[model samples]
Target: MRYIASQIGRSIRIVALSLPLADARDVSQWLGCNANASFNFHPSVRPLPLSLHIQGFNISHAASRFAAMTKPIYNAVVRHAGSKPCAVFVPSRRWARLLAADLLALAAAQKRPGRFLHARPDLVQPFLKRLSDKVRNYVIPAQNRVPSY
Candidate 1:
């Protein structure tokens, strides 16, 4: 992400991030510039809420938390996002496939397009076979480094 930012010479703003034993604020700080350096520590240094969402899909805690959320949570997310495209990230195919079905169903019903991206789509047969072709597969670039690290 930082590489992309540097390439574009634009400031990066993070809306949300989830990682195991990682600090989003510290990451933001590391990537921030001059006056906006403080903004890096807390992506939301401004009064407004940012929209970027990041998470480690395979983390147990994240999975447990997601499990605890009721369907209404998903509904609320879709509702809040309105017609914008939504992306759900998963570290593994098992969870991605499970969630993809539900999300795709929601998108179909809502008439919105949602994406199910996985690091290794080949590992998930169901995802490969059942997922809409519109779902994209993403592989993090090997050299893409974030100051957060």
Candidate 2:
């Protein structure tokens, strides 16, 4: 995490969303807070708390074709990761539907044996009731809010 001075007299915690692999040193030197933050550039170790977010997919429904297109991406991701892997993000109801559809497509594309891993959320209950059971279980629950008068 990085910190920056705030106009409201609070320190803001910052984390870079992503940076090019080539500019790693410059980003750390400039954004890192400690004097010896330079040592973070060492090549031998993996970094902690990395996050990846893919956005802008319609969340209400997942179609068969879209699911087919995404199967390769998911397969590639799985092949690159370590064993005992877990996914942290939640997809909207639409995404869940899409993912389910995608998985079906994946199953169709390949004629051999397969294993499925579903996404899971840390939170158990959600405020919204209209979402599907799969989505509700897999996503961070929304907070119930009273409308202002």
Q: Which candidate's TM-score is highest?
A: 1
Over 19-75, each residue of candidate 1 has an lDDT whose tens digit, in order, gives: 221354466556663445433235355354446544333546876756654255466
lDDT of each residue in 1-149, candidate 2, tens digit only: 23335446665554554422445667666664455544343333445444353434454454544555475555654565434443523347666566654544454456311234233322222343665554433333233222223
How well does each candidate superpose onto the true structure, as a TM-score? 0.32, 0.31
lDDT for 109 in candidate 1 is 58
Model 2 segments more than 4 A misplaced: 1-4, 9-69, 81-114, 117-149
Clashes of 2: 5
| Candidate 1 similarity to native, TM-score | 0.32
Q: What would the C-alpha RMSD of candidate 1 be, to one decimal place?
A: 15.1
Best by lDDT: 1
Cα displacement (Å) at residue 27, model 1: 3.7
**Ten contiguous residues with the weakest lDDT in model 2:** 140-149
